[model samples]
Target: MEIIFLDQNKWIELAQVHSGRIKGGPIAQLFPRLVAAVREGRVLFPLSVANIMETAKRNDDVSRRLIAETQAMLSLGYVHRSRAARIEVELRAAIQRRFGIEPERMPTHWAIAPGFMQAFEPMDELMASPGELARVRRMTSLVDPAALYLNYMVTQDDTRRREANAKLSEGLSALVAQIEGRRARFASESLDMRRRIYAAQSWVDHLDVLNRIVAALGYSFDDLSALGDSTMRALLEDVPTMNVEVEMATRLEAKTGTLSANDVLDMQSFYTAIPYSDRVIAEKAAISHAQQAKLDSKYGVILSRSLEDLSGHYVS
Candidate 1:
């Protein structure tokens, strides 16, 4: 099946079509075909953590429910792992590739579970009696539409939403402040200099992923510290998602537009979707950013803003 990552806005548009609020549009035209493709097992729309978080933080319950229902039906609750988890997976493979060793393969199946897997919180496992566990397992179904809806609906709870959104607001404020601060600091640097600096800084920024990768490799920090600058750059280039993230950041950071949380979320979405998904249908800005980095060509992904363009594929 073709893996397509739809941008949150596109998903909303499709949601409108599904809700019959939109009578005519590219998304409306494409809706039934897309659904048939999904039902036929010819195409799969995988949800990103961005999709879940963005939808959750919306203030409109009707709109949220509309989107939640639409996504639950189409996505069947498939979602990419959290950002750290995704990078850790890619970093591990990048290490193996550097050493010319065949790494453990990626998960062959799209992630499927209840919609809670799409949430930002970590799931706590519970101990259950063997017979009870068996009974619950038999009853558990990832494909249950209501379960997925309820998963997203949890975020709509007033107290929880306020708590979650407060943190998100703080993050957004800090991100914007950080960018403006960096822009002022780099005011006199040449474009080339800034790009180079950002590329190097990108590696340092993902220290968490690097830490996990080192531990998994059974190596101490000092053991790999001597790999040298050039060697590190080469390994990062081989790491598809990191390469995409850094390249996109360099271009974006060079620009003068006021940065927002949406931009960071787009980067998060692209970092995962551009490298892994066969087709990435995202917003115009994100698509342009990835294209500017030549990510689509390098990664062999069909990156487009037009859902109507999807007409040619997955017709079963």
Candidate 2:
């Protein structure tokens, strides 16, 4: 029986019907129908096959079933390794021509469609580069080498940024420790000398440490920012911060007012404005209230607020 492309509703009905009966059909049964449909040029089954493969990955059972079905189909035809290799060479040449670089120099697999590979063969002259050979090897394990190379480049760039941030974190930790150690030593001096000698030294050490951390962070931020605003924003928003570090940094900045306007802008821009706007405004208001409470408790500076006053101001 010839299969036809079903409309959305018919497709949904077919899915419901086949969902139970085809629990684990032989691979040959599933794809041959589709492949035959493609061979006849009646429908575009390649896209359907690709879509099924992607969908299968989301569930193990589906993936296993799909793999079994595909395997059964592939077993029907004898795939020529030499033909595949020649096709790989053709693809490598195409890549080199497009990018001005050999595929093997790329860090990821370059895969091509079986049909495309079978249709083209590489000339011997195009097979001269070692990089091209290496690319062919990598592509053997991948679906598409060019796509894989692009993904690899993105991953490598992120990894480089993460390594830079890690180095900066280590530097900040050492500086913080050094400043704390200096403060402890200065505190151990005689009481009279402690107040006179350590007063300025203590504040200076604390400020210096904060300044260095902020400066290091700024440099890291600048490097990521150069990549793109979105990447920079994601890095800052998703960066892991220890509770102790966050609290300490906040207290230090509160005392020293060392966090500049630029730093605030960097952080504000990093967060998503839509969902975070109200939350951020509320948090800022809470901080203001907390500061007012501290003043009232310590300095007898009582402040009052009414429902009318609260409603009068927009959070933004």
Steric overlap count per candidate: 0, 7
Error of 2 at 159 (Å): 2.1
The local distance difference test score of each candidate is 0.72, 0.31
The candidate that achieves the highest lDDT relative to the unseen native structure:
1
Residues 1-316, candidate 2, lDDT per residue (tens digit)? Answer: 1112111222222233244544444422443354454345432311122122222223244433433333223222111122223333433333233333444553111111322122122411223246655554455356442233223223335455456546654655565565455445654454435333433343344444333433543333243335565542232212211111222233333332233322332222211111111111112332343243242233222222211222222222
CA displacement after TM-score superposition, residue 4 of candidate 1 (Å): 0.8
TM-score of model 2 vs. true structure: 0.19
Instruction: Report the lDDT tens digits of candidate 1 across residue range 1-316.
Output: 7788988988888889988999886677788988888888787787777887788887888888888877876777666645554555677777766555688875564232334453232430122356644543454453464454556565456788879888987987797688778877897887668767776787788877677677777776565566666767787777766788777766667777788888878887888677778889888878887888788889899998878888776555
True-structure lDDT of candidate 1: 0.72
Query: What TM-score, computed on C-alpha atoms, does each candidate reach?
Result: 0.85, 0.19
